[model samples]
Target: MQNTVSSTEAKPKKKSLKARMQKFGSFLSGMVMPNIGAFIAWGLITAIFIPGGWAPNAGLATMVKPMVTFLLPLMIGYTGGEIIAGHRGGVVGAIATMGVIVGTSTPMFIGAMIMGPLGGWLIKKWDDAVQPHIRQGFEMLVNNFAAGILGMILAILGFFIMGPIVAAASAIMGAGVNYIISVHLLPLANIFIEPAKILFLNNAINQGILTPLGLEAASHAGKSILFLLEPDPGPGLGVLLAFSIFGKGTAKASAPSAAIIHFFGGIHEIYFPYVLMKPALFLAVIAGGVTGTTVFSVMNVGLKATPSPGSIFTLLAMSPKSVSNFIGLILGVTLAAAASFIVSAIILRRDKTPDTDAASLEDATAQMSAMKSGDSSEASSENIENARDVVANYDNVKKIIFACDAGMGSSAMGASLLRDKVKKAGIDMSVTNTAINNLKDEPGLLVVTQDELADRAAQKAPNAMRIAVDNFLSSPKYDSIVLNLKARDQMDSSAAEPKPAPAAKSTPSGALDNIDFAKISEIDFLRDDDKVGTATMATSLMKDRVKKNSKAATVKSLGINDIEDDENRLVIVTPEAAKNLKTRYTNIQVFSTKDLLNSPDYDKMVSELK
Candidate 1:
């Protein structure tokens, strides 16, 4: 009883920490995700339209300042505000942001992020407080005037108070970076950066902090090394290379492909999960980051602008068009990769799991997940074993989705990774990704998300099977999921025996009699005993087998009662279900499952669709 009580008490604390992290991640994502287009726009203008750029158009380049100084800050403010309190909040937030942008010589992006949301929150509070007291006749009057007054006061605060503070902060941050460079201690930046990157804070550090500093430096010197710190792929490259060589089982096989994607494809996020798979790998990434920073500092090299994708090609293209700069870029990347690879290889070799046993993998997975969950107590053997049961319900899911705060970068790559594995195994599973906000529960759907965002994903798709992993790029969970799906497929194929071979030609009775139709649709699978399980051996049983073949116009909006009472649409079910329904409902036409599955040209149609 004491143990159970203790365990119960621990769960809320774990949930609380997770909630805080999720909120922070959401806040940071809100600030960065919507503004990525602006970043890309500025990067392109700086890279190709500036005087030193490939196109070198001074006229077009004039748009850079307006875009950065006015447009970018305003957009950031608007987005932050909109996140807090909708459009009214966004308007005031942009207004308040101007105060910070006006006095600062540097880009005031970080300041905008703070001030915009603050302005929004202030207005939101005022509205919330005054909402009940306001008279009906004074609604518009109070709303408009209050908003304007709030906007003006906040603007003043931004200019007089927040503006100077931001300038000072920027100066201090810039000076610190410069001092490190001056002392030849630039490589130390990785000490802080590597750990932050591992925490999924790469976007915040790069876009929120470093970009402004790098832009300021670049404005004067035409280039800055600060741009590379957060976006650098070298450390990630090294880690993946090490894993490819020294990792066990599925990790070993996946690492090589991940390495190619991280290094050449310009997706640094691909390697983050690899490091997460083994937390000890953090030291390897840190060493590699330091090595790369040191090499770049030594060579006095910098890019003309930030490399958006952090791709090798983009990095090379943005390098100062000079031999020394080119050499610095190559040396930095190579050395970083080598340093990280060496350290990671040592760590992997030292921690080598010789057997790749399921129990061992579960413990390792639990440890990783527990660390990600911010729960220290979950490291026990019993807790680790229990974690394995979290996904037991997902064993036969047909569609898997990788979800993230932002749908594109890491989630997309993860889905692609699984899609390739599924396709190679000749499974017709659908694998994809979407933003967590867009996630929805569906029959037979499994949602995979980073453990940090698992709570949000669960809230969004409660009915879907959820697999939360510490990292998307690599997780033991993926291996388990794949193995389970393959096993289900094998079982399915074996179940087809003893039944008559599927009618090659369209008979009145068709493949539907054998296929588990409920597994493919929104309907629940019901057995004669009302138990739900795959009743057939052919694991490759098609989905929507009835609906896809016949023009059995589906009334998707109909409720169970509507389907029972109305005769407007055909209701397809197994013969047993049809018999059960016939005694109660006289109006609707009931089609046999086999008859629907054996629609005209059934074999050709099924083959073609497959």
Candidate 2:
């Protein structure tokens, strides 16, 4: 129900913790992803102009050093600042970053990430404190002088303090990477890499952490193995190959198409659902990763740059135009895929579990969350806590934002899709897309995020009404939202278009078997512990149905112990909640449903209520 968990519940906070880590990792990447074009330009120049490169132009090679040392880190700082305080932030961020840049021979990406945000924050705080007190006509003068002075101070601080500290940290990290490579222990990183990728943290790991390390290593050695770790599609390719041959029904049919998109189109996200459907596939990917890395290590191959989409062509393009490295790279990818496919095939053939398709992405997430929290029994039922975490009132919803790890791709497309639907429905609303880290909690804010990202969205915007969707391209949730908005005009006057999707079988078999209808004057949805959100939603739905049908019964969601034991009152709950309620009440009529969020049976029961 309401996603509120009981204080005494022993559930692990793994989901929330993972979300926070994802958020932080994404923050690091957010500074770099936007500047990928710059990174690519430098990559291309290095690939073609260095003495060992194909064209071997010493003059163009000079561009490589300055680009990597100055242009890239400055861009990162500017972008990072832009994220914090907008245009002014970018200016000061670059100024602050220049300090760190001139202070060290190493690339200043990590330093820029820190100083840029710090610079923006300082200016923002100063402006907040000083702007209001400034005379109206002198706003521009005061702001300009303030930014310049602050930038100078921050630049001095960065050159003197943050720069060396970050340099030492980077040096330590570089030494660690060198040690890992020397001992051939880097391949073991895939144990964490493959799993985090499934959680949609691939970009964060690759661009945020690995890319910087790769850049640092590549500058000296002309290439880095760090870049290949996260972007290598070998393990995912192997898992998909197994799924196509061994997966059954929807999963099998979808595998071929997903595989094509993942391998050719470079959308690795396409295969995540497949691996998640059968978590044993984790071993397959991990095996593939280990095998692939071992192969890469033995062959002495590395990419000159990070592959953006992890597509084969991109990977090939980023690799040095050398036959030996090319063959080694291909061999690594092939061996990795073969390793994963073998493990995945055996696991798939032996386990005859029903297919879990892309459509059930959210369900899979909740179940996985449950399992991780050590509550496997709750996995068979609906969400341990309902998907919709309603900390704010729907009536306060005035703005809707679609959020994702990277704000540019899916979230934008999803926002545009929903914006069109809202427009078509004649609703005036601001539909926008933003990075999850940028979520601002305020009244009238509603956030729609991809199924896997729901937890992160919640932690960011707990005060915003939230909706999680399986696919941004098409979703009944979008229609339901539009209908809910339209229904605001006549919340109870008539049943708004029966929800976009069929309402959970209309009636769960035998759930409402023996209920006395005429005697009940009020229907109560029990809200306790994790059931608060669900109970609140179910109660609202029932009230809408009763009002639409002109029924006499009133519906409300209340604490489980708040309702008195009365024959005239009816209580609706999940089977688990029903048991707890029954322990406390003898006369109140209690009914149960496996899915409280989408039960049409409640509509039926409400219509028949006195």
Which candidate tops TM-score? 2
In candidate 1, the residue pairs with backbone N, CA or C atoms under 3 Å apart (3 or more residues apart, or in different chains) clash, namely 492-537, 492-538, 492-539, 493-539, 495-537, 496-537, 510-594, 513-594
- Residue 163 C-alpha lDDT in model 2: 92
Any runs in candidate 2 off by more than 4 Å, and if so which? 1-15, 354-401, 408-433, 440-446, 462-464, 470-610
C-alpha TM-scores of all predictions: 0.65, 0.68
Q: Model 2 residue 361 lDDT?
A: 40
* Model 1 bad stretches (over 4 Å): 1-26, 132-142, 350-352, 357-407, 415-447, 455-465, 470-610
Q: lDDT scores for all predictions?
A: 0.67, 0.76
* lDDT tens digits, residue span 245-309, model 1: 87876577678888787777777777776787689989999999999999999998888666766
- lDDT of model 2, residue 381: 24
Candidate 2 on 1-610: residue-level lDDT in tens? Answer: 2222221222333466777788788888899887887888889899999997889988888999999899999999998888889999889999999999998888898898899988888888888899889988999999999999999999999999999999999999999889988999989999999999888898899889899889988988899888889888889899988988988766676678667767775667667777876788899999999999989988888998888878888889899878999999999999999999999999999996656532444333333332322321121122224322211134456889988887755577678888998897677889999888788776777788777787777667766667666556444456446544543433322245564322111123345656778788988876645655676787787778889999898887765424655778887777766544433344677777777777767666766776
lDDT of 2 at 602: 67
In candidate 2, how many Å is residue 435 off?
2.2
